[model samples]
Target: SSLGHHDIIEYLLNHDADPTITSIKNLTPYDLAKDKETRNVFRRYMAEHMDKWNWSNAHVPIEKSESTSSASKKNGSSISGKSLDSSSSLIGLPAEMRTRIERERRARAAEVRLNAMQNRGTPKPLTLPSIGNVICNVCEKSLVGLVPFEICELKFCSTVCVKNYRDREST
Candidate 1:
């Protein structure tokens, strides 16, 4: 949602939060989503429960996610943790390096999920990484709306940079 509280947002969606319900400003939940991941939550739900909600009336913008297909996990609460898309942020790294980066990413996500599961007594606010404003070390391009492609203490704009950095380190 607008607040980017993934846990609360997912809970509401799972519990039948109506994305079609618009605000006074005429913004639906998808419209108010602060980032890609938040929108993914809505996309995942609409994909799994196609008949449960009137999606066409929800005003979801087209191409917001790849979850439009029937990628339903059969009553799964979080489908994202299971796999990464082909266009993952770590695309530029070598196979071994990509594997390492993905493991790190998955570990971070798993930690967040565990925290959310444990805090079921009350809805607690969660904060995600703020790597959007940082520029890539190699290309100097802004990383906004892009993945926080990283390795060790270094962050890069792309996997190629990560590979280039590693190569530079060796030679």
Candidate 2:
């Protein structure tokens, strides 16, 4: 949750609210503390009560109510075991963890696609083959697959070659 008020945080801490509870970004109240005052408040609270905080109790098991179980049966969901509640399943996960998981999944998919493309063989490079007999001004090589650049009708192999030629002329 976005922590804006130090007094409210302190009040919550004084009661029984878990200070270690993280938001979707995996940021706790301490992490979200923006101002020096808020940070100091969190720091002080942590210093005093850090040992008392029960790490195991952080994840409270969600007990399926009778009504929910009966409703699931009526809906004819053949899936066995406790019904998965999307929101409840994510209740313990920090937002940062979720984002990281999603990013990793996308990266893996991209890697698979890249591997598939690679296995299909290298794509043909664009060339000015039709132009014929055009040589790179700098390298003095045939511009086969390499694109030719024209600076005042003087052909070069690439922009880099053109820049190099220009630099040489300027010197």
Q: How many backbone clashes does candidate 1 have?
A: 0
Root-mean-square deviation per candidate: 17.0, 19.6
Question: Which number leads on TM-score?
Answer: 1
Q: Please, what are the lDDT tens digits per residue for candidate 2 over residues 15-121?
A: 98886686643446665676756655655565567566742223212234557657767876536544445343334568975555446445546545644643474
Give lDDT per model, in order: 0.61, 0.57
Q: What lDDT score goes with residue 49 in model 1?
A: 80
Residue 123's lDDT within candidate 1 is 26
Tell me the lDDT of model 1 at 149: 78
Candidate 1, residue 13: Cα displacement in angstroms equals 1.1
Which stretches of candidate 1 lie above 4 Å from their native place?
61-171
